[model samples]
Target: MKMEPIEINEITGYWTFLRNIDWRDPWLIGLIFFHIFTTTTALLTRNRINFQVILFLTLLSMAYFSEPINEYAALNWKIFSKQQYFDSNGLFISTVFSMPILLNCMLLIGAWLYNSTQMMAQLKSAQMKQRSRKEAGIATEAKKTQ
Candidate 1:
């Protein structure tokens, strides 16, 4: 059997590539809905630990399923030619997979920093109250001894 090379034109720009994405793909749709659900839950939940756990799971799922997601994108885009696939795969992966992960990581980091700061403030307040109580006790003891 003989194989013939298939020709593929260069992808124009980010918008064009995005426009070509197959929104109907089950994997893509599922990921989108899952991400939305995670984000909503993270926002609504008061527990910082819960938010962190959800974000971690979301990131893990995104990383694990990236291959299948990219495969679908490639098939949808019809980039079957070896040279074309290689050339475009990086863009596909970055746009479809890495971008979401990066954005979510940023959100996770922001939430961590915000929660940490709030915790530190709380600890400081508690320590100050304890120190004041100790000082008051010491003053009372000195007065009794005098």
Candidate 2:
């Protein structure tokens, strides 16, 4: 007796879709590498100017490529409004696309906070040093007068 093929329903189909993704695709690999490089630079760079430049470039690139990336994802995942087979594709695509953006924004905010705190600490130290110098000068003048 001949056996029939199993029909892929919503539950089983998603795993199949994920498994079928072409890991060897050059565009996908490039995108992965780019994100990695940018994320590491954002995390490790000590120079504020450099960090700002990298952040600007990253945002620019994302804006320039957003439409193409969305189209590519939709094509690969067969995401469509009419199809009920993979309703989760919208969530999946949004998550995949937004994660890097969210990460970079968080990093930028963290860097800003760190810089502000450092500046405040430096200002406090300078003020303390100036106050000490003024007190020492006043004491020396009083000794001279006596």
What are the lDDT scores of the predictions, listed in order? 0.66, 0.61
Superposition-based RMSD of candidate 1 using all C-alpha atoms, in angstroms = 6.7
lDDT (10s digit) by residue, model 2, range 1-146: 11222234523655565554454545546767877877787767746666576685776677556666666655664332222222233443444455666677677678878888999999999999999999999999999999
* Range of the 10 consecutive residues with the lowest summed lDDT in candidate 1: 1-10
Candidate 1 lands at a TM-score of 0.66
Measured on C-alpha atoms, candidate 2 has an lDDT of: 0.61
* Candidate 2 least-lDDT 10 residues: 79-88
- Per-residue CA lDDT of model 1 for 87-117, tens digit only, reads 3456767765667676776777777788889
Using lDDT as the measure, the top candidate is 1
